[model samples]
Target: TQLLEQSPQFLSIQEGENLTVYCNSSSVFSSLQWYRQEPGEGPVLLVTVVTGGEVKKLKRLTFQFGDARKDSSLHITAAQPGDTGLYLCAWEGYNKLIFGAGTRLAVHP
Candidate 1:
């Protein structure tokens, strides 16, 4: 069963624009993580929001965990072309990672 759902599975935007993608689940999670993957590359951990209502930032990206830990959001401010990639919301599972359907973002210069 799919435990998570991501919205706007595809997004195309101009550089400098801000955007946000979401990950949601009906069941609460102990922790949630966000990963980004570029073409021909493995997904890399961006940020992990472990606590409810917790927020973490990495340069222009911001990750937030819902108070109930049932959802999460990733916001990018002034997004750049370098940010173009597949964004996956996931959770650590038995030393592996279970991912979302993923949000593919393309930022044009």
Candidate 2:
């Protein structure tokens, strides 16, 4: 099974601020994904990075995968209160998916 470690377990910021979070692992993964979740709901996939060093942007959000394929990061620009939620990283391993502990974000307006 692939193991993921997420940094800065929690974060709080004002709207319009920018922030970044990270997910890392010792084992290489074929693909990595980012997700956002709201309270009492399931996580929503934001982006998936497969090629090493690949970068994908969704609106004000950006995702990058490590050249070694063992790490990833997410950056959000001009945060909004609507961005408040749980962010997670997941990877496929041994025919299953393993998730990180997750980062909880609170953006106050």
Candidate 3:
């Protein structure tokens, strides 16, 4: 069985703060995707990093895939109130998906 474990299931931060969330697993995955979801809507794809040690940045958000492809991390710099939402990390392969427990971020302005 494959499972993804996420740290700090809930985070509350003041606006303009920095935070980092982590996803870890023992099994390797073909692809890892990060998504941000708002209330009553599906998760929006933030980024996908396939190569190990590869980092992708979108504005104040940065994502990294583990060298073994079994883990990933997301870092937000100077977060804003708009960043308050649920962040999820998912592993996809062979028409199957494994999702993390999900992290709920609250950015207070």
**lDDT agreement with native, every candidate:** 0.94, 0.94, 0.90
Q: Estimate the TM-score for candidate 3.
A: 0.94
Comparing 1 and 3 by lDDT, which wins?
A: 1
RMSD of each: 0.9, 1.5, 1.3
> Model 3: residues >4 Å from true position, as ranges?
none
User: What shift in Å separates residue 86 of candidate 2 from its native position after superposition?
Assistant: 0.5
lDDT of 3 by residue, 8-89 (tens): 8999999999999998998887779998998889999899989988899999999999988888999999999999999999
- Structural RMSD, model 1: 0.9
lDDT of 2 by residue, 1-109 (tens): 4389997899999999999999999988899999999999999999889999999999999999999999999999999999999999999768877899999999999
Worst 10 residues of 2 by lDDT: 1-10
* Clashes (candidate 1): 0
lDDT at 92, model 3: 75
Clashes of each: 0, 0, 0
Candidate 3: clashing pairs of residues: none
- Give me the displacement of residue 93 in model 3, in angstroms: 1.6
* Model 1 misplacement above 4 A: none
* Candidate 1 lDDT, 16-79, residue by residue in tens: 9999999999989899989999999999988889999999989999999999999999999999
